[model samples]
Target: MNEDTARLSLKIERLEALLAVTKAMVTQHDLDKLLDIIAHEAANIVGAERASIFLVTSDRRALTSKIAIGMEETGLAFSIDAGIAGYVARTGEVIVSDDPYGDERFNPRIDEETGFKTFNLATVPMYGTDEKKPGPLGVFEVLNKKDGDFSEEDLEILLALSGQAAVAIENARLLAELRLAQDKLDRENTRLRQRFLKEYAFENIIGIAPAMTELLSLASRVAESTANILITGESGTGKDLLARAIHGRSPRAEGPFVALNCAALPESLLEAELFGIEKGVATGVEERDGKIAQAAGGTLFLDEIGDMSLATQSKVLRVLQEREFTRVGGSETVRVDIRVIAATNKDLKAEIEAERFREDLFYRLDVVELCLPSLRERREDIPLLAEHFLEVYRLKSEKDIKGMSQEAHDVLVSYTWPGNVRELQNEIERAVALAKPGETIGQEILSEKVRAAAPSPLRPMADAVRALETGLIARALKESEGNKAAAAKLLGLSREGLRKKMARYEIKL
Candidate 1:
């Protein structure tokens, strides 16, 4: 073959490779993967020493290098109007510099910083029809294009690549939105589950906090078994959810999961509720099975078991110990096979010490004691719970709420949610139903009680938050004497979360 023909054949082969790369890029719906693919392929297709793709920040005033290929230290960052690439991004035009040093707009500071010499550069704006101030959709730049200066054919190829990159970027954004919507739906389902649990709530037992994660795990482990279980928590937490989750996961899932607030019923009637009455038994005319019989082949959740009157307590104690109970006024014995789960917000140990709750009965029911952490302990779960409730109310109310504003997230993450998850759920639902659609539920959305407790920090908010975060981590580390795990715990952060913040703030210790 002739030399020209040989060269033409090689060019055709490279074009085919480029086409494949473009197809692969299009197939990527994730922005990060698409960016790296585009950056790598751009370098190979243009035969440049390096290629990088940058996304414009929301402020439209900075270019952040998201992907970099074959570039030392992997980036060229610039302000919106600062350098050649920045000018292209700022002006919506191609910027070509034959010699990096000679061009007025060529800022070789990145080369200086990375210790790489930039001989040539070709920067082009990826424009979109957004019609706002009209800026680059994104910016791609290459260093030292091979086979002479970047020609019209090279620009055409770059333009085609730009279109593909934009498509991938837009698709990635859409996918993110879809994922968010799906997450919202999942949270709504959780809210419905919470509602089911509410029907079974009693004596204001609070087991809704994540510290209850341990309790939940334990409950699920023993839920299907016939062993009696106890739910332990401070008063007013939702132990009902734990009971329901256990029942829902159990072998007797289809059977009734009956509940009674032992504290609320009269001692005389409590006996009637637990043991069945015959048709002619006493003044109560109806022949009905008691809670134990009603909960046959299922779970029976008893709330405030510690508060049962001594007389009634002895009867329950007998049923629990012997698997049998007689009706209040009838002599016939009723036998039931049941999974018993009991909750008491009172400190059972103290109750036992005070002799308010029977020691033997406590031990019998305490076969599995699930201690749910109060809201003060698992404060980290608050933001997650808040988001869950927000999603729920938004969907049910058919509001255009996108998500929590950064301010709302900050407030949520900071507050000590005294009322636990239930309180937070109530707050969010109220806000979603009350706030105007398409607007964030701000501090205004919160109850007056919570609003008053929030920090009255002054604004034009001092550039203090970033500095404060950094200072707190540093202080904790110093207090821990550089033990990172302890420092993270002191700051109420997980190890990974702490590491990320430390890296972000450049806090070495």
Candidate 2:
């Protein structure tokens, strides 16, 4: 063949090889495998003995090898401004070195560690398709051309290959990020659905006492309103549960319900948790949306709000007053449309008098106050609550327990439940675990504290007096046909005093 024809045929062959490598790279989705393919093909296309692909780390401080051909180990890292690859990454320039040992920018430690001798090499920078990523994504380097020193034709081929590899790498990265975002969204949706199920609705709050009836009636009336709410109750009185029920019944039920415990974190961390933080606010701190931002168009439930530091209260007051806030270490004002619900076991009035809580913040959150009755004051609801819990635990444990015995029920009703409804729930769960299948829960399985509180024949003077007083009141009420005034007159006691005794002993006519 003529010399000119031979050169033209060689050009055609190189173009065909490049075309095949590009097609293979575009089809590979797995990042690690695609990088290996790129490294392998770069060497084959340039007739090189080995090749390596080094990607810049997220911090932009260094370049780490993702795939290194002819090496037993990969992931070798060096400063981004240290070696020949680093120079190409920083300057976005290509390097063609016939004698790497003589180049000042080439580091010889890699050679000493890998024990690989290099005669000629070509290194090119790979740019990302993302506009946000302005700099080169990484460096693509091939070592020791087999035929001769790497020529201009070899540099051109490596550049084309590197460009294709860069596009493929960016595509794979974007796909991974999209999948992660989709997974997070799906998980959030599942959590919201589980929280607002029919079982947790406002109508399902197990209660029948006058106090509970009144509370529920007021709550239902206010559920559709946009007014802020403050729930006050002792610990274990179902404050969080009530807050969720209110959200479920509100017009914003379709939006997210985000909660935060004001007492769970320190003052510094609490500020960041409630208001979020800017990226680079501290070492290794990434940007994120706070609970208030997450609860936009729905509700933000702050539990134990009385325990919030005075400084945090001031910032929270701003959010309540202006409906906007600035993130920690950030100046941008972010506005949100959300309802606020604050709950605490502490007396906010006392906290305000003690100069610990902000009065303005309290008034903002207390637009509609709902103070839950302690289990002691609502004794009439004990049997219903216990039965509800029994059914729940029975199904949860897969036990065949039918019901509680009368003696056990009486003991549960007599006990002064300092821990309130939560204690009763735990007790029922424990009894179900200990009871045999198809058997009723008896007093013998009750907790020692509860059983000890039961009325006994051989009791102390106080217990004997209370038991006698309870029996007399029950008899008087029955004789009077459930008339409190007539019962009090027959027992020689004022009506209010007699009513108090009845409540204390849980006496029913």
Candidate 3:
């Protein structure tokens, strides 16, 4: 072949060799294996006798070699200030020397320790991704070129290999770090799930009051059956918690327990959301099974059932009466074998009288009625609930708080919790977030409204007429545990009239 053709052939072979080296390096994921591959490839590409890959230690004070081909020992560490490789790393410069003994920067200690003789070598700095001012990642060095001395071409080829090596090293390191982070996150999620199960277990329901005891006993008895249940209580009462408890204790404990609030969805979408939908039912709709189908062999909890529209209620009544439902815009009668547990804060009896709700639906749903006492009615359980919530939030916030102080306990018990158990839970969470480390939550951290809530004083009568009205209302609400209907009846006023008076008096629920 002519000189030009021969030169072209050599260039093509070199490019192919470089491509092979890159592909090999990319295939390796293990850091030690990749480093060894990079070292061996660098030596082979440059026609060198041996090669070593050195990485900067985390402290940046030394270079550590985990992989060194053509060496007695694989692991080697040296100070960055000591040897020829160290000099290249520190200065981020390439070094090509025909005689290593002639160089002042060449340290003979490693050679003596390994019982290997040092000769001609080319050292190249492996740089990180930042091009503006590249940082030294490590050093790649090869010793004793096979043909003769280390040449300029050998240095250039080694430099190209070292660049690929640098990127592969960074990628391997990042992948290892991500795996470790994911493992940590997985462990934390498992811990949280176990903690939730332990905290909300049936035995740990917290209330020791006679009323709470009776309610729980009834719930436990009914949990074994497939009978439809209707849970009645004021807003924020633990009706949802009771529903979950029943599901957890049932024969289908291993199955899913799906819950949907009836008041949360619009009337137009409620039917499809509960009973599944067919394609072409509306714009952008997909064929899918809904909550009823999803809750098969499990429990389906319908919360705030009183807020469901008359049309939606009629559909639900059919589900209960006939054990089947038809999806919106479809005639297919889908049958579900789910245990139904419905809850409502509104008086369904009162609703039926006003023609806003159906009487027949009420009879179908009230097969086994369970009434949860409001928070005020069960005031004796406040301290227990507070302690439980404090523990929950303390773990969440990663704080060392022990429990509530005496003043804090007093504030919690005295406040008329119109929002019931849920409101108390929110207050405790807020207190934990604001609490100092290693300290108990105090009344100082409570909301201003809760802090200012005080019982009427005996000597106070700024306006006897207004004072009597407010006092009587507040007393009745406190006695009834914030049950407005009961409080209204006790005061001989309609529910709507009592609501207006409570609003005018700034009585919050």
* Whole-model lDDT per candidate: 0.76, 0.89, 0.85
- Candidate 3 residue runs with Cα over 4 Å from true position: 2-13, 130-134, 208-232, 243-344, 347-371, 375-509
User: On residues 160-209, what C-alpha lDDT tens digit does candidate 2 reach at each position?
Assistant: 87887788878888899999999999898878676675656877898888
Candidate that beats the other on TM-score, 1 or 3, i.e. the better one? 3
TM-score against native, each model? 0.48, 0.57, 0.58
The window of 10 residues in a row where model 3 has the poorest summed lDDT is 454-463
For candidate 3, the C-alpha RMSD (Å) to the true structure equals 12.5
Clashing pairs for predicted structure model 3, backbone only: none
Cα error, residue 142 of model 1, in Å, equals: 99
Best of the candidates, lDDT? 2
RMSD of each: 31.0, 14.1, 12.5
- Flag the better candidate by lDDT, 2 or 3: 2
With candidate 3 superimposed using the best TM-score fit, by how many Å does residue 385's alpha carbon deviate from the native?
A: 6.2
Better of 1 and 2 by TM-score: 2
* lDDT by residue for model 1 (76-132), tens: 567877778787887778877788798888777787788878888788777655567
Worst 10 residues of 2 by lDDT: 191-200
Please, what are the lDDT tens digits per residue for candidate 3 over residues 230-300?
Answer: 99999988998888888877887656688989899998777778998999988998898889989988889
